[model samples]
Target: MSLMPDRKTIMLVLKDVTQENQYKREKLEQERKFIEQTRMAQMGEMISMIAHQWRQPLSSISATSMNMMIKIQLGEYNLETKEGRDECENSFVGQLEKIEIYTQNLTTTINDFRNFYKPNKLPVLTSLKSVVEKSLKIIEGSLHNDNINIIYDYNFNEKIELYDSELMQVVLNIFKNAQDNFKEKGIEKPLIKITTKERSLIICDNGGGIPEEIMKNIFDPYFSTKDEKNGTGLGLYMSKTIVEDHHKGSLHVDNQEAVEGEGIGACFTIKLNLSSQSMEG
Candidate 1:
């Protein structure tokens, strides 16, 4: 009998990934839509804040201009005598200085808001404290309008690499949430305490804690505690995505009981690696 050469059969299995690819594409599109929607909602809130911020400065400018006009009409300055001319010049300079200061403030406010809305093309090296301060500045007028007290307890100022404006958005979202909660609960003494430690930021509000049942779902997309009119349900979800997914950080929340005479409420903590290596990764 002739020995037959051993033959081996190889089988190949192939999968058509068309459906999977299509699903992924659709998911990305949905996320883009969510981002755009969230941005529109934030734009509305920002416009309101901008109006609040500009109101006083604009009023001051108008008042200053009117005062100067009145002074000119009344012929208050004696321009003939040397001393009178110097005094008149000084008064005009003083009024001009005030107007300049107010104008500068208005310009700064515009720049702040513009930089905030401008998209970041690259990560920036910045201290967490600075980012928090910037975010606070943007929303300061709104906070003042609502009579909300913001307390700062910064224990960290290390520089880290990240998208500052995006982080600002996250900060603003948390502030807005606290503000809304304060209004809804009618907290008499609304307070938000911001504390930074190591590589973490903690924001605590005394606007009553998140309900136990809803706490688990706070980070879920389209989940909201506020009614349809007030809540887009994307703030916390986008915030979580920005910190964790985009920056490789962590965001967590919990209810804190009253302690040391402090009011009880919700607390949000964000942690990011401080090392440059981590950011690069």
Candidate 2:
């Protein structure tokens, strides 16, 4: 009689990843929508800044055009004699140059605002100082109108890879917050000091310090100290995300007992490191 081998057994396993993938997709979609919302919320402030930047240039252009028209109407330029013609030519050329300069100023202002709204496609080699300067240029007019002073102290200017436009947004957020605080508190001689150190950018404003109890929640999404009508509460949250999640950096704040000898205020620090991939570039 032949002996038969015992029957062999086999096992198989299957997993359903549909729910997991769906959850990921939902989270991503939510983040994308929130980013757009944040941009829209900032649009009002952006428009205000553009108006501030354009006002002076537009006024200058108008004045120059009026002056040219008046001169032509009144026959102020003697065009008969050779010498008179030379003088008229020189005057018109000077006026034209002024108009050109004013027009260029208008163009630059628009470009700055346009670039601020444009999303970056690639990381750029830049420095914290450079980014800070660009951000300041955009808001400086508004600050001047508000009588807010900016003191910039440079210590580190090393080049690093970053999404410069995104970083600019973070800087602008901090600056706008400081300005609002100054206005709200009615701080006298309002001042904001910016300092760049080894891999860190620090901004401090003498607008009274943030309350310790509420400081912890500042980075949480949709948390705001301002009234509902004034604050969408996404600025700091988006800023923290840009610095930490997108750039792989760190952002923190503290109550500075004294900032540049200007008394107690809120201070924000942004620390960045070169990414592994960017190090070679």
lDDT of 2 by residue, 7-111 (tens): 665678989999999999998898788788788988888889989998998898899889989988999877888998898889889989999999998889889
TM-score of 2: 0.89
Spell out the clash pairs found in candidate 2: none
Candidate 2: where are CA atoms >4 Å away?
1-17, 260-262, 276-281
Q: Write the per-residue lDDT of candidate 1 for residues 25-58, one digit (tens) a residue.
A: 9989998898788989899999999999999888
Look at candidate 1 and give me any clashing residue pairs: none
TM-score of each: 0.89, 0.89
